[model samples]
Target: MNTQEHAVGQVHRDDISSRMGMWLFLFTELMLFGGMFFLYSVYRFTNAEAFHIAAKELNTLIGCFNTAILLTSSLTMALSITALQKDKKKLSIFFQLLTIILAFGFLVNKYFEWATKFDHGIYPGSDTLLAMESGEILFFGLYYVMTGLHGLHVVIGAALIAVMTRLTAKGIINKDSFVKLESAGLYWHLVDIIWIFLFPLFYLIA
Candidate 1:
């Protein structure tokens, strides 16, 4: 057999391992967040009124947009991996760039929402919070915590994609492309699923 055939076989094996790892990692993440959800439910039950009011205050439209952005990004990421498997490096780069752009868009929308709220004294520990009714403040506090963590994950995922993009551009990663992209997709999908729940909790609870 020629070198190309050997390379192809190795690449195929790498793809399988990459996919399996992604599934395992996703399962562990689900369990981790499942515990958090359990605690959140306990708080939600005790403060239903406040949680509902807080949900009403958020913009559901924005949440919907972000959800779409994340879902689209994941699709693009998957396409990029497919392109690489076919040895279409340029197309792979294009989709990866598209994914980054979508992630950035989500962050931009979040920035505007967070800044506006901050300007209006709506964040946790603000004077409004200190003097406001009890349950609402707690709801906002949890809101800030969970979304903030999710946003940080977005940043991390984007950074990882950036590294993958560079690696591909310089020809350092070819058949191994699935390894990096799969890990990213796993994390991205997790973030996307979290937002699915968050949107309804923050904007459509009533």
Candidate 2:
């Protein structure tokens, strides 16, 4: 094959490699969260009452709002990909920015929820929390750990999207080259799906 053909073949291989690598990374992330979910199930089974009671303390309204925000963001992320693929560069950038804004809104709401809990002396290692029953304590422990970890993932996903937005704006991630944006969208969707599980588990359990 000619040099240009060889270069094109190498690019194709690299694209496949990038996708495979992203999938493998996503698998590892799922395993991490899946193990946490199993632990939560064991605890919930043993301490159903405490878990239920503790869950009631969570603000379902805020949780639902955040869920809606994330779900909408997922749609925007998908639309962004579609727009890019269709060669609508401006529209794609708009959707990407909108997705980022939605992400920020979700985080803001989450912060307020967490802050309220802290204000009420319900955070990890606090004296008030320590004074609670063992089951209740365990409930709060899992609540903080699980939700906090998920929040971290949201932050990371937003950061990745922000990078993708910048790249898209620069024409680096355009109709002809958008694997990075697609990967970012996949990650953002995963974050949203995880929250869908979390919202019911933590907010609606009560």
Candidate 3:
């Protein structure tokens, strides 16, 4: 085989390696959250009434709105991938920017939700929360910890997408090497998926 052919083969292998590494990282993430979910489920089962009461305090409207936003962001993330694949650099960048905006919107909504909770004196270890039933306190504690972790993931995903957007603009991440963009999309989708479960569990389960 020619040297050029060998070089192409090597690049293809490198791409495969990069994708595999990302998938492995995602698997580890899933495992981490899976354990949390298991604990949440057990607690919910044991404290059914208190959990329901606690969940009722959450704003379902806001949760649903954020759900919609994240779903749309997932769509835009997919569109970004497709645009890059089609060699439409401008469209790809546009979609990436939209995804970032939607992510920020989600965070803004989250801030308001948490603020409302705090205003009601419902935060973890708050006097009001401490006065509540043990089960309700447990529910809120899990709620805060789980959602806070998910929010952190959202922030990280947004930052990664921002970097990807810059790379795309600079011609560093184009049709041939848009794998970084794809990785960011995958991570964003993972974040969205976690929120999907969280919305129903924390907002609608009541």
Clash count list over all predictions:
0, 0, 0
Write one digit per residue (lDDT tens) for candidate 1, span 1-206.
13333354434554666677888988887777677677678889999887887777788788888888988998898898889989899999999999999999999999988887798799987898778777888788777887887788788888889888998899877865457766776777787888778777776785
The digit string of per-residue lDDT tens for model 3 on 57-111 reads: 9999999999999999999999999999999999999999999999999999999
Report the C-alpha displacement of residue 48, candidate 1, in angstroms.
1.3
TM-score of 3: 0.94
Instruction: Give the number of the best model, judged by lDDT.
Output: 3
TM-score of each: 0.85, 0.93, 0.94
Q: Report per-prediction Cα RMSD to one decimal.
A: 4.8, 3.2, 3.1
TM-score of 1: 0.85
**CA lDDT, every model vs. true structure:** 0.81, 0.90, 0.92
lDDT of 2 at 195: 90
Ranking by lDDT: 3, 2, 1
